[model samples]
Target: MVFEVIGPIFLLLALGYLSVRLNLLNKEQVGTIGGFVIKIALPALFFQSLSSKDLHQIWYPGYFFVYTSVTFLLFGIAYWLMSTHFKNTMSQSAVLSLGAGMSNTGLIGTAVLSLLIGQKAMTYTSLVVIIESVLLIPTVLILVQLGMQQKANVAEIVKKTAFTLFKNPLFAGVMLGIIFAIFQIRLPHQISHVLLMLGQTASPLALFAIGGGIVGMSLKYVNAQSFYLVFSSNLVMPLLVYLGLRYFTDVSQEMLHAGTIIASLPMPTIFAILGQAYGLNEKTLTPLLMSTILGFIVSGTLISIWWA
Candidate 1:
C-alpha cells in the first residue's frame, strides 16, 4: 500500500523531468501549465474539498493553531536570519524564507494525503491550504513586493495587499469553500461535478510541471546554506509540528499524522519560482531538489510507523 502510494508520485515526477529533457515540452510551456494548476485546477480542488464537508470537518482549531504557529515561527526565523545575518536583499530574503517555511501542500499534499486518508485527505489539506494560501504565501509575497518598492509606506502596502489577496485565485477558492462549508450550502449537481473534474486535474499536471521546471536545474550549487534550509524545512519544521501537537494538544490520531506529514513534505516548487523571480535561482533550487529527494525517506518513515 505504501509503495502503491509513493510510486506514482515519483513516477509522475520522473515523467515530467523526462518530458522536458527529451524536448517534448519547453520550460515556458511547463510554466503555462503550472499557471493553469494554480489559477484554475488547484483553486477548484480547494473549493470542492471544503464545500463538500461540513464546518465541523473543515475546522480543527487546535490543528490550525499549531500549524499556523509553527509556520509563522519558521517563516519569522528564516526571514530574520536571512535579512540580518545573511545580508540578502529584501526580495531574496523573503523568497528564501518561503523555502524554509512553506511546504508543497497544494500539489504534493493533495496527491499523497488523498491516497493515504481517502476523502478525509481533502479536509486535512483544506486546513493546511488555508494556512499556506491565505496566510504564509501572502505574507511572503507582500514582503517581496515591499522589498522591491522601498519607498512604499505601510498603509499603501496594506491596501495593496488586501486588493492582491482578494484577487488571488487560491485565496478566493479557500474563502468561497469555507463560506459554503460553514453555511452548509450545496452546489448544483452539475457545478459540483465540473469542479471535481477540474480539481481532479490539479495533482498530476501540477506534479508534471514541477518535474519539467527542474530540467536545467542542477545540484552543483548546493552549499552550507542549502543544507541549513533543507534541515530547517524538511526536518525541524515537521518535528516541531509533531511534538507540539503530540504533547500539547488532543487532536485526532489522523490530524496528528496529517499535520506532521504535511510539514515533513518538501518545500513547494513555488519557492524556487519566487526565487527565480529575484535572481536567487541556485539559492532556492538546491534545497528544493535536496528536500524532494530526502522527503521520500522522511514521509515514508512516518507512514510506516503510523499506518503500519
Candidate 2:
C-alpha cells in the first residue's frame, strides 16, 4: 500500500528532474509551473475539498491547537539550539527554525495524504494548510525580520503579516470553503466542474515541480545545521505530535495518523524561496529540503505502514 501510494509520486518527480537535466525544462519555466500550482491549482483544490465536506467535521479545533502547539515548540527549540549552541546568528537561526517548524503540507503532503487516506483526509489536510499559513509561516517571518535587525515597527509588521495571510490564496480558499460549507451554498454544476478540473492538477504538477526544483541542489551543502533541521522536521516534530495525541487527547486513530503523516512531510519548498527573499543561505536550505524530501520516501512509507 505504501509503495502503491508513493511510487507514482516519486516517479513523476524523477521525470521532472530528468526533464530539467535534459534541458527539457529550464529553471524559469519550472518556477512558472510551480507558481501556477501554488497560486491557482492548490487553491482550487483546497476550496473544493473543504466545501465538499461538512465544516463541523473538517474544523478540528483540538487537532489544530495541538498541531500548532507542537510546531511552535519545535520552532522555539530549533532557534535556541541554533543560536545558543551552534553560535549561528539570529537570522540564520530564524531561517533554520522556519525549516524545522514548517512541513511541506501544501505540496508533497496534499499529494501523499490524499492518495493514502483519500478526500476525507484531505479535508483535514486543508485545515492543516490553514493553520500553517495563517499562523506558523507568519510567525516565522516575523522572527526572521526581527533577527535581521530590520528597523520596522512591530505594529506595522503585525498588520502586514495579518494582511499577507488574508491575501494568501490557500488561506482564502479554505476560508471561503468554510463559509460556503457553513452556509450550505452550492455552486452551479459548471462552476464546480471547472474547479474540480483545476483542483485535480494540483498534486501531480506540485510533485513534479518539487522534483524539478531539487534538480540543481547539490548534496555537498549538507552540514550539521542542515542535518539538525532535518532531524527536527522529520523525526522530532512528528514524534511530538504522535505522543501528544496519544497522551493528551482522545482523537480518533485516523486523525492521529493524518496529523503524524502531515508532520512527517519534508520541509516546505517555501523555505528556500523565503531564504532567498530574506538573504539567508540557499545552499543550506536547498540541500536540506532535498534531503528531507528524499528521506521522506523511507520515513513516510514506514509511517503509512504503521498507521495502516
Most accurate candidate by TM-score:
1
Per-residue CA lDDT of model 1 for 215-307, tens digit only, reads 887797687678878888989989999999998889988889999999999889888877788898888888898988777679878887887
Model 2 — which ten-residue stretch has the worst lDDT? 282-291
In candidate 2, which residue pairs clash? Answer: none
195-234: candidate 2 lDDT, tens digit per residue: 8899888888988888888877766666677788888888
TM-score of each: 0.93, 0.93
CA lDDT, every model vs. true structure? 0.85, 0.79
Worst 10 residues of 1 by lDDT: 150-159
lDDT of 1: 0.85
Best by lDDT, which number?
A: 1
